[model samples]
Target: MKAYRMLTEDEVLQLKSQSCLADDWNNVLVSSDFNTAYVHHTRFSGNVKLGSFDGEFTLKGGIKKHAGLRHVTLHNVTVGDCCCIENIQNYIANYEIGDHTFIENVDIILVDGLSKFGNGVEVAVLNETGGREVLINDKLSAHQAYILALYRHRPELINRIKEITDFYSNKHASDKGAIGSHVMIVNTGSIKNVRIGDYCYIEGTCRLKNGSINSNADAPVHIGYGVICEDFIISSGSHVDDGTMLSRCFVGQACQLGHNYSASDSLFFSNCQGENGEACAIFAGPFTVTHHKSTLLIAGMFSFMNAGSGSNQSNHMYKLGPIHQGTLERGAKTTSDSYILWPARVGAFSLVMGRHVNHADTSNLPFSYLIEQGNTTYLVPGVNLRSVGTIRDAQKWPKRDKRKDPNKLDYINYNLLSPYTIQKMFKGREILKELKRVSGETSEIYSFQSAKIKNSSLNKGIGFYEIAIQKFLGNSIIKRLEGVDFKSCEEIRARLKPDTEIGLGEWVDVSGLIAPKSEVDKLLDGIENGDINRLDEMNTSFETMHQNYYTYEWTWAYNKIQEFYKLNSDEITVQDIINIVNQWKEAVIGLDKMVYADAKKEFSLSSMTGFGADGSREEKEQDFEQVRGVFESNPFVTAVLKHIDDKTVLGNELINRIGHLA
Candidate 1:
């Protein structure tokens, strides 16, 4: 607590001589060490408390400015020690400004009545028609928003979540807003009922209202020129600048929305980037990036997605209000100028290349391609598993994470072949086999879920899914027996047994955290039963699931191994283990070769057309090599080759170790 004292008569006369005026000298209270020499051309009204202005701030280019109140009006405000408040066009009211904060040329920063600072503001995300509303709060996470937006079928769960959020909001409600230490709000316009955090830099921002910038010294936030936010909660390490406008939004950690991007009623989770685009009521999970002008993302749910230039979606057929919504699972991408009518669900890691009006649901066929020809949707399943771009995307996600705060809100799983996608591949294989069985094996094409799949694509999809499954199961078994020196078949079987039974049935990607559905069901049950009532507890549950992922994954993979190989665990021998290892080796090698072939296309003759402009063919090849290195020397290609070599060695090592067990 600061020890405030009334200004001495001589000090008040000195302040008056310095052109500082107060409604009543008795209304102003100053710290014991306050100096009148630093008070100049300032006006004080209503009860005001001033701290000691004894520190000097060093600016760029070796300039120094003494910390004091100059040319400003403060009302019922408490100015902390060592702060410089200058040139306020209008009075700042009901604010507790912290130490070392510099507020200059700010117009009308005030808190009117009691404000929650944007908490309890319901952002209608995912579905624009107003059914799914995620309450914006400082503790909002991707998983919380996911359940709140998609779990509408369970009204009790939604109500419980809302109650929890409301409780949090009410707990933080305050009559006075705060500006934390080391903050700089310069040349801003009309900040009302906003709470700014420590180390935040707000310069040239316009009209921020009812928000909380949850910035801290560990991960500071920067709101730059011409930015406007209303009813928002921006988490730590985020930058909202360059005329970006937000309304009723919750931006998560390390997100960047700039370059005139406009978003309304959207929930953008960790590391999402939006530039020069407009989003309306979208639930953008972690790593959703849209960097194109005229690309509008509306009424959609997406995670780990990239929207190409001019990519768009329609949520209404003009029959009713905009009531439809769609979901693009993790790692999905849209090609330039592509469009999708809503009420559709694109599977994880799928590529959409053209306009499609039909509401095709490919949730069971992950890692596929959806193309449109003659207004007909064509599905090519499991092809993306071998694409060099897909591999690069999966590799880049973890590397691209921008969240620097130690208290990260999102639990992101970066594995491309987890139980989530593997379960989809399993269903896809079954669907393909069923199609082949129903429509004779000689059929040229098969129709599924309003999309057509050619016989060749179907067969290739089966092979691709098999390779992926083999790779996953083999990986699990190898890891399970990684360091075990088995001397007999009994030991091998015992080692192959799962350590837990938590991952037996289905699994789901809850935004980015991939866990078994049964575990999620238990969490949901707890939430519904009112056992898990706090946001912190819910996040802890998610963290527990994330920490135990490999254990749960082994359980799922163990069951799949028995079903896929038709092997009983007790009767399995070293030869069976060796057979599985050989299959895993082949699958690994085959996939690497496929990725290498796909990468070679980047160096193909057709791809070199625009490389050496106005040059002969030989010169073009030379220029192409200079720009994009040779296929074998390409980094991704080299990695693929190295992966093949390492997998071969690993398989041999495992075989040699298991060979002694026989």
Candidate 2:
């Protein structure tokens, strides 16, 4: 650190000649190479330090009018090299401006008092009033925030986590604000108690109060025209532009908030896009996107979810103060004009249609449709299992991950069928069976969790869940024995055995990361015991669990093999393998046919209504075919047919292998 030095007597006289005044020239210090040639029409107040201005910077947009610092005051400020601080309508006090930064036509960039720049701002996510407030920080991940917001019942765990977050916040607390290197704050209004990071673009922003724009060179944040943010931490690579308003929000990596979208007390994780919509007190985990103007997402937890136009939720019953909340689990979708009453839980990959007053909880029955019949909520389970859109969404999420930064805060798992949903399927099958058992199986309709399930829907749901279960287990068994050349039955049996027994039981989807319930419990226990104190360490545990998913999945699948085949592992015959293979082949083909039939609905006459706007029927058919290629040649259809062929060959090959042993 260089020693602070006062301006020379001659320099002070030269500044006096130029009508510049300093509160005691001794209070102002500058680097040895600081040039007074560029310090024209500038005033210094309180304690100020100036770095060397020897470095030249070529500003973007070819407006090189850099020799002005008129009508601006600096206090206890350290101005770095090549920074043009001009037309600051109000003073910039207690700040450190970095090199190559352009601060032109800005109003009041100041740190009024001791500020942490919104590091420890508590956001009451689920419950609006209080009780479950998450202390947001620079490194807050979705999993950490999830646990902190939802697990408030365990006070000790919450306190321990809060203490850790407080420690982090205290470590970052500073007496002065910082404007990082290469930042441009041109034509902005009112930046108070905020920290601007490196390479950030804050142009024409209305106001930024008490926040941290965590922009960097790799993924710079762009706060464009009319943006207003308060008590926020916008992570790297995000764009908050075009009249967007944010309050008490944690905008995650590579997320886009634009086009008048307003969010308050929401946590939007990686790759979440909000355009022309409004979100309030929502926990938007990774890839929760809503681009419709009329959509309003309030008081919910969602991930990989797409909200259709006019899709909304009711958080108030006119009794309590907006107390109710809902959970639309991962990959859940809503059609246009769809509505759900709060205190509801829609399962993973489920599709919701129309308005329903009944607060249905279908958390165990994933891939279902919750449709409204008259005023009744009708639940159809496992129908979305073969949906091409579901598969396409799963495939697209990974490709659309926009985080260019090396350090990813969110750990997202994009598997369509994991132990998380599979375990739910297991429970869902039991729940349906129990529904039938209780209703006598001959009932016309069954009631469950504020929703009605028709008799045919119940039977079809059971069949679908069974098929999915068998498919998953058979897939695991086949994968386990994929590369192994089993010359004998003993070798095949040995190969089928799981490497580890840790993943035999229930599984959970903690936001995006899917792991066995036992593992999550261990992590929570670790946090409770002060073992997993650091946030990074906790995230590493999550990563470890995610990495070991396949291993644990095999363990769970291996245990279910005997139950599915009705053969004890100790007394297995070669015919058991043949029987399972034949069953697997049947399930695979059956699902394919259903998917094919579902795909055909897309090419129906009803689907061609809007196509060929002014054309005859023949032209309409041609236009529809031209726009959406012939069904036989469609990629998904071809893939389905090829899947049938491949599975047939695979089953026949397995049967042949078993026949040799017989």
Candidate 3:
């Protein structure tokens, strides 16, 4: 609370000599440290307040300018200490400019009537005509948005969440906007009904209307040239610039949207990037990226996905007013020119390669490849489990987190073989077995969902799922008994017991945080029952769930082990643990060998066609080695081989400890 004093008559005379005018000189208020020396060519009206000109701003070229008002019109504005306001094309009204801030060059900054600054704005996501609407706020997380958009059947939860959001929005409503400390707003056009936070940098922006830039010293928001945003909230560490346009959107922390990217009615969460693309009514979860000008993501939900050039999807197919929507589960990829008809759900870590209109649902068959052949969808299940690219993606996500803010809004899990996908493998194995049981084993092709699975592909998929299940279960048991030396069968059985019973049921991936479905339902029930009524409380629950993922996962794995291996937990012995380790060693080696072979294909002779132009095969080999490196010595290949060796040694160490009992 800054105290302002009426300007002395001598000070008013000095200001008049400096060509400063006020509607009534008595209406102006000045701080005790306000000096009339730098106040020149400024017009003041309607109870304007001025702080002291006690600082200097250094420009990029090391040129210094003393902070004060020059050639500016301030109407009902309070200029804070050491601030500069100059050359406004129109008046700046109803704004509280913070200390040490610089505001210069072009257009009006005002709040007309009362504005909520983009909070509680209903973004009609997924089903654009109506149904799924997410009320976006400043601190909305991906899990919250996921529930808001998908869990519409529980009307009580939806109404309670919306009412909480509305209360928050109304609490923040104001008649005057604020521009915070250490901000730089230069050469910008109209800023209307926007609240700019601390350390924000806005330059050459065409317009910013009804928005909140929640910037701070740890993570500042950057708004660059030709950007236009309305009814939006740009969270900390986000950059929206370069002719990008956004309407009715919420961009979460550490996001990047630029290069003429356009989005509307969408929510982009942490680590998502968009450039030269367009998104409409889409929920883009963490790591969802599209970098092509011809790519348009519409009416879809995606996470950990990449869209190649000219990738597209048709939600309505010119019917039903664009209400149809689709979801590409986490870690999915689409090749160039690929397309899908809506009401489709692709499994996690799958790849789509061609145009398909079948609306195939592969949510149970994760890590597969969906291809189009003669207008029929071909399903190749669990093939991606052996893909080097899949392993690389899983390994890189944790390293590529862009969130620099100490306080992260979304708690993400980057494990590729978590209970979420492994449980899907369990269901997928059962589904494949059912398909084989119904269709004769001699049949050439079998149908499941809307895709066709060849007999060979089906058999191969079953084997793939089995190997993955073995690998995951073995991993859990090994990690649980990592350091313990068991002497007897009873000791081993006691060690195998789960720590908790909460994760005995199904699991789900809520955008990025993978946890038990029971836990998610428990939280939702709390929300509906009025036990968890605040946004912070919900986020705290999510954080707790994320922190305890492994504890809960072991519970889920314990149940599956009994089902998959037909073993009673109380009767399990040291010999059984040794056998599990041996099988795990085999599974790990098999997958690693497949990955190594996949890497070797990149170094095949045919891959050198365009290299070593007009040269012998020997010369081409040399050129290929020079550019792509020798096959055995390549980094990924060496890593895979090393992983095999490490896991083998690990399994033997455990076996050696328990071999006597076996």
Candidate 1 regions exceeding 4 Å error are: 60-62
| Candidate 3 accuracy as lDDT | 0.92
Model 3 segments beyond 4 Å from truth?
Answer: none
The TM-score between candidate 1 and the true structure equals: 0.98
Give the alpha carbon lDDT tens digit for every residue of 1-662 in model 1: 76899999999999999998999999999998898888899998899999989888887699889999899998989999999989999889999999999988889999999999999999988777799999988988898888888889999999999999999999999989999999998899999999999999999999899999999999999999999999999999999999999999999999999999999999999999999999999999999999999899999999999999999999999999799999999999999999999989999999999998999999999999999999999999999999999999989999999888999999999999999999999999999999999998999989998999999999999999999999998988888888878788887888888888899899989999999989888998999998998999999999999999999999999889989999887898898889999999999999989999999888899999898888899999999999988888888888999999999999999999889766
Which lDDT values do the candidates have, in the order given? 0.93, 0.88, 0.92
lDDT of 2 at 169: 91
Q: Return the top candidate by TM-score.
A: 1
Candidate 2 clash pair list: none
| Model with the higher TM-score, candidate 2 or 3 | 3
- Candidate 2 residues 1-662, lDDT tens each? 66657889987888777767787799889878777776766778888888776555466787565533455788889988777787888789999988888788888889988888989999989778877799999998898898898887789899999998998898889889999999988899999999999999999999999999999999999999999999999999999999999999999999999999999999999999999999999999999999999999999999999999999998989897899999999999999999998989999999999997878889999999999989999999998988878877887999999999898888889988888888899899999999999989899999997899999999999999999887777777667766555688888777777889889788877788888889888888998998987878888988898789888888888788877677777777677777777778888898888888888899999999988979799999999999998999999889889999998888787677557886
Worst 10 residues of 2 by lDDT: 62-71
Q: Provide backbone clash counts, one per model.
A: 0, 0, 0
Ranking by TM-score: 1, 3, 2
Cα displacement (angstroms), candidate 1, residue 470, comes to 0.5
Displacement of the residue 593 alpha carbon in candidate 2, Å: 3.7
Candidate 2 segments whose C-alpha is farther than 4 A from its true place? 1-6, 10-19, 54-61, 65-71, 570-582, 633-635, 638-662
